[model samples]
Target chain A: MKAIALKLCSVTGMKWGIPFVKLFSGEEVLEQLKEIWGTVGIPLIAIVTFLLIWHFGAKQIDTSLGQVPGPAMVWEQTKALWAEHVDERIKADEFYARQDARNAAKLAKNPNANIRVVDYTGKPTYIDQIFTSLKTVFMGFLIASLIALPIGIICGLSKKIMQALNPMIQVFKPVSPLAWLPIVTMIVSAVYVTNDGWLEKSFIISAITVSLCSLWATLINTALGVSSVNEDYINVAKVLQLSPTKKTFKIVLPATLPLIFTGLRISLGVGWMVLIAAEMLAQNPGLGKFVWDEFQNGSSQSLARIMVAVFTVGIIGFILDRIMVELQKLVSFDKKTIA
Target chain B: MALLELHNVSKGFGEGKYRTEVLKNINLSMEEGEFLAIVGFTGSGKTTLIKMISGLLSPDEGEILFRGNPVTGTSHERGVVFQNYSLLPWFTVYENVALAVNERYPDWTKETKDIHTRKYIEMVNLTPALNKRPAELSGGMRQRVSVARALAMNPEMLLMDEPLSALDALTRGTLQQEIINIWTKDKRTALLITNDVDEGILMADRIIPLTTGPNATLGPEFRIDIERPRDKTELNDNEEYKKTRNDIIEYLMDMGAEVKTKKTTNYRLPELKPIMPGKTFRKRKEEDKLKYF
Candidate 1:
């Protein structure tokens, strides 16, 4: 205030020496912070600085190669996605009826009084699409784990089994999910038949493909984890003459749980990522198809709309991982010894 | 027949490209209900000796007999307490002990198993922490829980590998007294692997010093003539205790220093100093002559 007073009131005449009060307080700023924060003052400062940097960082990002859109565009895209979803709700029943012969004609034609002007594009609601994708991922993830955990445990416990499986595991593990898609599609298409034959058996195909691709990482990592359990613990188990089933349930499983959980988390992450890509390529009704269609449209805000899906994916992946970590901590009561 | 016997025992590790001998010509016999302490320099095959006795590791050249029956792999008849606390951390103290009880006495009901587990838990003075996991327990407390776990199975021969080395001095002494009390109460056969001379004097009827590896063998056995329930604090007044402790210490110090000097010599070192192909040889005979002489 005094420096401003000297500059504006005294015509820059004591500007240097006029801020004695301000300087005295300024010198104590760090001291005050130290008193308030004790040890965390520096980290607090760093966090504030980082937030400032992030808020002004939009212009620096190059959006040419599918980088995340800025916050303003992302928010607008969310509204646009909502509008698209609303448009899709108007004609969904009619489109399914035209493709397959299973629709109630009156409901398809009327769709109640909820009918609106933009009703031709004909899509499922965004909520429905999200639910559909979530259902597939959960199903795939469950089956993958159900198969992988036992097989992985068997490989871990027996040297003979491990030796036989090692080559097959190595060969199949590196094979991409994209590569396996055709084979999986053919299998499900051949194996799973419907009562009405309405939607053409796409549901099971996508889920199975997702599972086959995602589960290898879990199985391999878990087997390795089980194999690495301390030899002394095995000795402990043997000396006690624990039955094989009891040994597996009690000693082996608990000892190898952290590793199994780690594999599960990784497999889950892969499943989520691959589902989006699989849905896009496989023409499955999911967030991927929605995002993929928007991208191909190339509207003025197409990129922005796709940005919303991208953000959702990232946030969903992060939340999924967090869920698994919390689950792991809950199940594994083993206090891991610090090596 | 002795309760446990090592007949001309010898052991080694690896084969072909990296073969190395660990134990050489170990012959010993233990009657039932005897407590023995084997004191040796670090890496003197004391752990290997214990492992061979427990059948965790097999001796390459001899038969380890439990009352004239050749030892195979691990069996509940001989229980081992490892150097580090290997209590399954997921289980509470009671659960950890109960694992062994459940395994050992599968025919018993859950109530009987609970009673069996709690009996040993109380024996180790860990009844209060029966529901506490290893992470929440202190080092000595964890060790006590391990002892409880081992004792719960009621193995005929108890094997301890420096079970108190990680504890503080006071805690070690406290547990030392507790272990002695347990041993005397049951009079089960026990073999303790320790480098502590005072511990050897306090706990064991006989102490054996092992020479340094890779040709390490049992050197000498000292019979502690001191009375039972030996007090670590007041052992200085006994003249025999003084002589035995000093003799073992002096013997172990020499063996320990020999290992330190001999470890750096790296008998496998090759090529760094321009060695010829012919010089790369297994000089076992020469090394043996140099070491044993």
Candidate 2:
């Protein structure tokens, strides 16, 4: 049962739970304690120390809004944000219920009347903004991956193609999301003229900008990875008389997948970061927009709320990175320890 | 008819002043079911010869024929066991073997492929390590998997590039015996490239010396007329084994001396030293018929 528990923890990526499982199972008590202290206790202590420092620092510092938000203020703002989210959800539910009743009455009054249930277009809550940001970043990341992987493979396979792409990659790689924003905005506004489309114009602009900025990392890394695939494996593929497509998919792709995942992880992180900046600058509906709005409002609570948003952005980024790493581990057959 | 033949093959790398010729006017032919070993110095283009026959490389000049057809590109007909084991590190021993078996016998049922893969894995005595990846296996075991992978392809011919050179002595000896046992069971045309003279004698029917490079060519052939299933310990005292070993070593040493003398003379005639073809340990007789400058 203890062995099963340990296995379950490992599979779930809850490796920190192993110590507790072992301790409960009457394994070496001291060893389990050491493992727990190294993995969990150390991190908890560090967090507490950081919070103490922030509390002390908050008293000394003064901002234009008021004081720098301490741990307590940030915690309070976090609770307030959660309450706002709940209140918004309740209001949406009530609005939908009222709409349904009104629609039924309209239908009863006139049998052939158009009785449409309109959507609740309330101001998005903090939770809703978080989801918006996640969606935008994912859309951008997906587009980047779709475009970059094939191009990278082509560049890797042919030296001439790589040479042709070299100058373009060099020129575009360092261009910031801020630099891409104006061009992306102009093109999206000019081309995407449809109102009430599946995606908002602002969302499309931000996503395209994110994709443009983030694709370089994946493209370069993927090219490097594909080129570095073992020559012996290629020779084996040749010896087997595998077709071109089979060789690429079966031998080349699998061999370079670990590095490709590394590239993807970087691209996702870059996309997320670029999305936040794009949202702030473009006034798109996301956490970045929320932060900007609160700052412009300049209330006492505004500083604490912005602090909450800051912590939220950090935690979400950490989670996104962890997800990519987990996915990489699942796909890579070479199970070497990764940092 | 020869199963594989190389005719006046010449290969070089680099350009102009940096150009180094690795093989020149290399002529060789092998029949079906014959085990031929080419022993050479470290950089003597033995691998180039093997690659030429395997069709991974094409000679800059001359033609390589496989059963009278010109060899153009790599084919499953010639299976290669590279000096480095070349097993995909991600794949298990069983998967590595099964990959080749499936490729070669695509029409075979999954069950048949599995059984075929297992047969060769068992032949290499790696049944216990079937599920283990290459990284988990020792050097010898990894090489065994490579050997198994190649054999599972069921190719018409086998090309081994010093396959046991990376192994320790005991493992090398054990694998050598395993190879001989497999060869005896299925008499496939085989070419082995090695620097180890004893290995060549122990495993091959005829051992040919590959001269030191900047244009290496095959020297005189030494036929090993020793009986089948020859024991190494017993052969240590055998007069025939000792004499043949000494003769081959003497020729290689002479070639080494020739290389030292070659540095002073920028352009010189290549020696046409020839020895008796079969079952003789006599010294090489300088044949005047062949000449190259």
Best prediction by lDDT: 2
TM-score of every model? 0.79, 0.85
Alpha carbon lDDT of each predicted model:
0.79, 0.88
**Candidate 2 at B286: error in angstroms?**
31
TM-score of each candidate's B chain against the true B chain: 0.87, 0.89
Scored by lDDT, model 2 comes in at: 0.88
Please give, for residues B1-293, the per-residue lDDT of candidate 2 as tens digits.
Answer: 99988899999989999999999999898999999999998888988888888898999999999999999999889999999988887778998888888789999998988889999999999999989988899999998998888888988899999999899999999999999999999999889999888888888999999999989988989999999898888888988898999899888888877887877587665786665673243222222101100
Q: Measured against the native two-chain assembly using Cα atoms, what DockQ does each of the candidate structures obtain, in the order listed?
A: 0.49, 0.54
Cα lDDT tens digits for candidate 2, A1-22: 8889987787666789999999
Error of 1 at B79 (Å): 1.6
iRMS per model, in Å, is 1.5, 1.3
lDDT of 2 at B190: 88
In model 2, the Cα lDDT at residue B90 comes to 72
Lowest lDDT 10-mer window, candidate 1 chain B?
B284-293
